[model samples]
Target: MYVSLVCRQWYAVTRAVLVLTRPVVWLETTPSSQLLPQLENTRTLIIKRPQSMKHTTYVTWRDGEIQCWTETLNRLRELSIERKIKINKIEIKRHIRVDTWLIPLLTYTSLSLTNLELKDMVHREIPFGQMMKLCPHLVVVHLHYRDTGYIDSICRHANKPEYEPAELPDRLRLQSLKLDNVAIGRTILMRILRLSPDMEELHLKRVAKPRSFANEWLNTDDRAEFSQHILEQISSICPNLKSAHFSYYICDLRSLASEFHLAIDRNLFPEVSYWSFKWCDLSADTFQALKTTPNILTTLEIIDDASAEDHCQQHLHEFLCGAPNLLHLKVPKTLFSITWFDLEGIVSTVGHRHGSTDSTTTVSHRKIWACRNLQTLHIGFGCEGEIQESAENTRLIFGYLSKVCPRLQDLTIRYSLLSLELNRGFCLLTRLHELRRLVILTQCNNDKAWNVDWISKLITPSLGARMKHWAAEYSTMNLGIARARHPFTSTVKNPLLHHLLEPSIQSTVNGGDRRGDEYGHAANAERRKEGQLSQLVPDYFINGVDMRNLGQLEDIVELLQDRISKDWQCWPSMGFFELICLESDPNGIEPFKDTIRICRPDVEVK
Candidate 1:
């Protein structure tokens, strides 16, 4: 408005540029008719209003707002109408009906629209076939219905005899489709897939079982059969599909087995390189079939299924042997207890070498090789036992990985117990010079041996010097103790660690309100009290330097006093030193505090 107001000449030039660029236009309230002309060239449009205004009365207002912008949507390439309210206390009712608001928008942008995202839509009978027909040029479509019940209702409506099917275009331009909590029938889902024959990625989450089956057994059987059929059809129909994800409440193991079998038999999914199955069970036969399949998967994630661990472990080698190019592997803890012998076998197989049965070879001469291309490894142990029993095994795994997987950059381990021995095992990871990010989730025992000092020990000079990011979470249920801490030492040459540790002034003032109050008092009196307190506190220095500076001296004194008052009599650990340094700043301490809070909310940074 200011530029246009400069002069008539300026107005004409600026308007023309605005028309050509057509930047994103965000509307929070009802768009007026006058504003429609200005948005004629807009490429992206977003309509998001506050929850307070998403009431029944505002439905008409939003409907008119969308209708007013219909004509201008002809040139629109992307549109997102996210009216879903995220407040936990408020129950969201239908704000805008899809048929009334969404269908018209689709019709208007039918010629040019490429991306469409409809989030938090109320459960209703959506003419999906007709909607796809309206947007023939759509390349990406994301729909998140409220729940599976709504999807069940839609499935029922679509299957009705009175429902008329729309004619789909000869070739769809769609490349990606994501549906959350959708429960359409097999036929309806197939119809939708048929419309996107060239899709490259498909993600279906929380998909409900069809309701047409009479009994639980029949429903499970039918679902499995349908799932297998869909995979086969997708392989044939969408040969370009490269990635797929599926998640559900009850997994059909038989269906998964059949799907893998069909993929092997028909040599399907040649182009697919990524697959994720959440809360799904896999049997030994499925793994056998997977091994037979020729697909060179780059990433495979199978999580949240404890019952399938034994089967996965028994056949994982076979399956992985087939996928020599696998780069990312995520498996349950139960399936990840790989022995030294198993490690050697995998190395030999991946490197295409045959090793001797004799065990006389030295560790160095025994060929450090396996999954050379693997870059990311995530293992979840599911909180079954203490880490003490498996400490040596876990350590050996790390030692092996450091030598074999030279390209490994990211590693994540969850739900394990940690002690001094385990920390030492982690230190062995220094051999992985390429490693950039490391995350460990463990329950720390209350014993003095497991203090925060162990964290510094894990970051050996070699690892600490190269590691870009490292995070750890520790808790003591026996003592009702929890603490989250991160290392932020600037003296270290590691720029990543320095950036992570850099203090924020605002967090310091906020986290140190009590100390800030004391500092606000008369300087002489505060110094006298600090001198007295310093005598009672132990002599401590950070990074081998005595704290003579005012900021460092004040922070340490306050921290000791707080610990003593709380009756936490344990000696100050490295965590205390880091906290004191983080709280030394009055303006820049939030990022450090937030890293600990978000990673381990139970641990008190104070």
Candidate 2:
């Protein structure tokens, strides 16, 4: 108002600034007299009702505010009406009646509106197709039904013979559609798809059965057949579809295998590069089908079912040989059992014979390295003590990963238990010049606590020189016998050895060593207090050692100062040393920060 009073030019600039800064506005109640005119030029409007607001109050506010926004709606490009409160029986029924103001507002702003989202709508009937028809320029539509009951009602109305077909323009501009927790039947889903012929992405999460067949159990065969039919329809209608996610139910594992075979046979989703499927048993036939379009799939996730058989391992090997372009592979841990021979085979297949002098081998004799281009590998193993039996195999697998996957950057290993012996193989990871991140997660006993020595072996000075991030976490399932000393405390504390090892421990220091005061009197009390503190503090590693121990702080500071001053050129400016000393060791970072400033004045620490 002050700017408008100043001059016409000033008023014009102020209006432009307001339009750019306040393009979207969220209102929980009717706009105040002061704010109404200020929101006249808003390009996007988001109406949100607080859960605490009374139903009657919401209705009054919504009606009055929407009526006042008639002129503003004409210029609106995006509109989202979301009800966060739970609706009572009365309110649900009341919401079923179409808000008289909504249709008219949509009709007037049809050409301008491009994005719309309706979430947790309590209405008994919402003409979704009709709304899309009215807004011909809509590019994205997200509909989250309140419950299966609402979806059933919509399906019933849509099925009516006298129901008028949605008025659609010559070409639909919609590119993305997301349906959450909807229970529409096949025909209704087909009709929805028919509206958006140029859709690029579609997401259907937790989709239930139609209202009429909510309790009906379509057998595995029937469900798979129906799914194949739906996918076929989608492929035929949306040629430009790039990504799709949908949950599946398979009574028989073979049904899932059959579905994949049929999809590949028909070349469904030929251009799709990303796919996520729920837990299922993949058969050899499915792997064979995957070979049909080897290079097309870039990201694939197949969650494992506990009851599923592990017969797909061989099939997976064959699939990898055929699809050498896969960049991301995630599967159950049991499917992968790396051995020395596997490493040799991979090296020979990829023609990466570094030290070998065997030049007589022909190209036909070499196998195709299936995952030559793989960058991210996630292997999830079951918690049945299997990891213990194959501990050495796990080590060999890690040691050879860089050799097999020269381009590997990210690796995640999930298992039930991990042994310390695996550390030897972990040291080989330093060979991966391009590797940046390594994560190991295990749900097992912490009986064998990992210390700085173990961490140092894996993240050796050479590897640490190039590695950006690495973490190892263990979650204990049951309580084990307690040890006398804190799990990480070393009996012989040599400053030189401490400086070299940089052990990762998990206990805080108690002022001084009271171990000799009494056998089990005050010492027990102190140990219990330290144990409680350990439980409160999360596990963090400094140079692979637990960050709780302050015993090696002096040694660490001296070592860092010396390294930064002498070998500063060779040291990683953003390496693990900085990560652990300055970043992970929050309570002890101050000392290292001071040391860096005093010693390496030229190096900047962030």
If scored against the real structure, what TM-score would every candidate get? 0.50, 0.47
lDDT tens digits by residue: candidate 1, 338-440 = 3323322222222211223122442222222236678888765432233243443444455556545657777766534332232334444544545555655
Q: Which candidate ranks first by lDDT, i.e. highest?
A: 1
lDDT of 2: 0.46
The clash count of every prediction, one per candidate, is 11, 11
Model 1: lDDT to the true structure: 0.47
Give one digit per residue, the lDDT tens place, for model 2 in 343-437: 22222222211222122432223233356568878765432222233433344455445445657776666644433232224434444545545
Q: What is the lDDT of residue 251 in candidate 1?
A: 58
| Candidate 2 clash figure, as a count | 11
lDDT accuracy of residue 299 in candidate 2 = 70
